[model samples]
Target chain A: GAGVSQSPSNKVTEKGKDVELRCDPISGHTALYWYRQSLGQGLEFLIYFQGNSAPDKSGLPSDRFSAERTGGSVSTLTIQRTQQEDSAVYLCASSPESNGFPNRGETQYFGPGTRLLVL
Target chain B: GESVGLHLPTLSVQEGDNSIINCAYSNSASDYFIWYKQESGKGPQFIIDIRSNMDKRQGQRVTVLLNKTVKHLSLQIAATQPGDSAVYFCAERGGLDMRFGAGTRLTVKP
Candidate 1:
């Protein structure tokens, strides 16, 4: 019943500081994804976690961006040495597919998102 | 490399009229497509989705049409309402990679 949720609805941090954004996926959702939305832009894929498998980090824009899912539930996206370009809405989504096979057509439930502003 | 794009950046339709948003994806291998509606200051909300096997799928008042032959997708809203005003995005998925199109802003004029 509870949809995906993120913490720290708004975060403002100085450039070069590290910030961590948290996401709580829906119950029974084993697939989680992170995306970034710039002002008036489309969603940019960041990372994805599926069950216990190694996370997909190909979408990470740079080495400064990293994410981890703990115990297959909550995920944290950490940005090291944040830049002004990193300022955007960080959105997390989850789906009910665990094996990744059924994920092809599964609908992803999104959270309210955490707005990160890098000064 | 995969990229999804929208033909129009904005669309304005009168209340009670129909609205259609178009998207084109470069990845022909994409097997799934989804439409999402995002209001200001909110995360995207799933509107509807269609698999590659199906050419069309209908929801309450929304319909998603996929033309795999041309790698094109469209979302049609019947009897557009003021509440339907928002940014609509189309996403294409192939395997574990998903790409989202630049959103189309829909403004319903009363």
Candidate 2:
């Protein structure tokens, strides 16, 4: 659409199960980011993808979290063996810059976010 | 630990009054700063941004000030209204890395 869109606006899964969240960024935005917002907490950076290159996975929180950007357009964040702590709102944002930005990525547009609840 | 914090987690301001939200970031290398507003059930929406090269930037009804000397950032909303009530976040970017602060809940009391 016109802005970033995230899938599974709300997900309820059992502990130890796996879940995948999707994101569709605005057209022509080369930079995409994933973040997690826990209850009564701030947004935590998860991953950053610039175009089709290897994404920055430093913020995945654990090895169970991984993400991939296909064709530099849509992205999916997969969490294996989910835990109660994984319950949070998964947010996605897109910009024209790579984080250290000036060309356009400086102002990122975020999605509505996916609320995940692990039982 | 790298973090961004605020002295007050919540602020109440009267309608039509000016509101100022502050942020203290721990990263000294951070050179770019941004302010975002996130309403309930919504993601953060960009407000304004200032680069390390400059200290201040102004936008529609909003202004962002960056004080590198003390590692502080502030957002000023002119004529604050009920529509401006939301959670405000301060984010910093350095060397291709971006981070967000805890955030401040702004309540515009009408």
Candidate 3:
């Protein structure tokens, strides 16, 4: 079975430029999540989408960060006016758990991730 | 704000030896925990997981122990091999989010 997939394995951009990272979740995976990992740091939750409901954006570091999962499958994380500090590996994952699941800890399959470097 | 943390940032073991990675979580509400391994230039791969109700779970050459009373978790790998060298992370699930620890880098020396 095909796993989650992300685009632009590596991206280098100047500060203040906007970048869009894409994620394609596995077929029938209702739960999708985005995370950021800085150099030598842990994974930082960014946003999550379940079915067609509103995405959880609580973990977004700032207002400049936003994400949208269109058609409940493909998600895109947009960082506006990117800062040098925004440089990190952007990871995407998906799970088969539905909205009615008792817990949100379902197994997550991750993509290779997009490495963004903001200069 | 809840967080998961590791006691050691790195661990080294001889090939074929056993290795243990420990993690501490602050959120008592956490009901599920997971361990992941990430190699260089790659995303994390799920290793094993355990619900709060279960104290221990086992998989091939791997074991996950969760102690909710003490908010502690550990992953043990038996007969560690060179392929086992990577960054291992522990994640605690609370509410609609899961928090991940900084991860411990394991090195299997042959």
Candidate 4:
């Protein structure tokens, strides 16, 4: 039982700088997802990875946002040339193996999240 | 370009009272719905979920109701407690990703 974990609880960086946020899913979780939450806003899907299948990057707002899950456990979300609009709480979540459809009752456990502030 | 949305942005209820949160989604194809509760400085925690096939689902002190015809969803908390005060969000999965609605902040008054 350790839930999902994210590193660098808070990050403040200059605009145009690159930042990398890391996430460690639950021990055996095979699905990892990244989301962004702006001030007073809801969670915005960024990307998702399940096992060895191709990562679903449809949610990525722009090409500057990218993510990778290595060895099927850890995932990193990298933002290149960050913008002030990218400032938000980046949340990571995980769940057990399923048909890739979260609607099927696969509960996603989330981490504390890494707050990013782009100056 | 469908999205999930909440009818109200805030709700206040007395402790031990029943609390109901409402949500509306635009995508008719969405088949799964979930409710999440998030406290300040924390990530969202799964509260309850309901499949489109079912009209209602109950768990613990929480119940989730889905109306496919109206594309509406609601989460009801029975005997609301102080611990239930938080921002609640509803999400719907239609395509490869799920869309989350702007959260509703719940305040439990003692």
Best by lDDT: 3
Report the Cα lDDT for candidate 2. 0.86
DockQ of 1: 0.48
Q: Which stretches of candidate 3 lie over 4 Å from their true place?
A: A99-103, B1-8
User: Candidate 1: TM of chain A?
Assistant: 0.93
- Which residue pairs clash in candidate 2? A97-A105
Top TM-score model: 3
Per-residue lDDT for A1-119 in model 1, tens only? 78999998999999999999999999888888899988777888888888745457778999999888888899899999999999999999998874646363368999999999999
Q: Any runs in candidate 2 off by more than 4 Å, and if so which?
A: A97-105, B1-8
Candidates in order, interface RMSD in Å: 4.0, 3.9, 3.8, 4.3
Cα error, candidate 2, residue B46 (Å): 0.3
For model 1 the local lDDT of residue A48 reads 80
Winning candidate number (DockQ): 3
- Show pairs that collide, candidate 4: none
Candidate lDDT values, in order: 0.88, 0.86, 0.89, 0.87
Candidate 3, residue B14: the lDDT equals: 100
Which residues of candidate 4, in runs, are more than 4 Å off? A99-105, B1-8
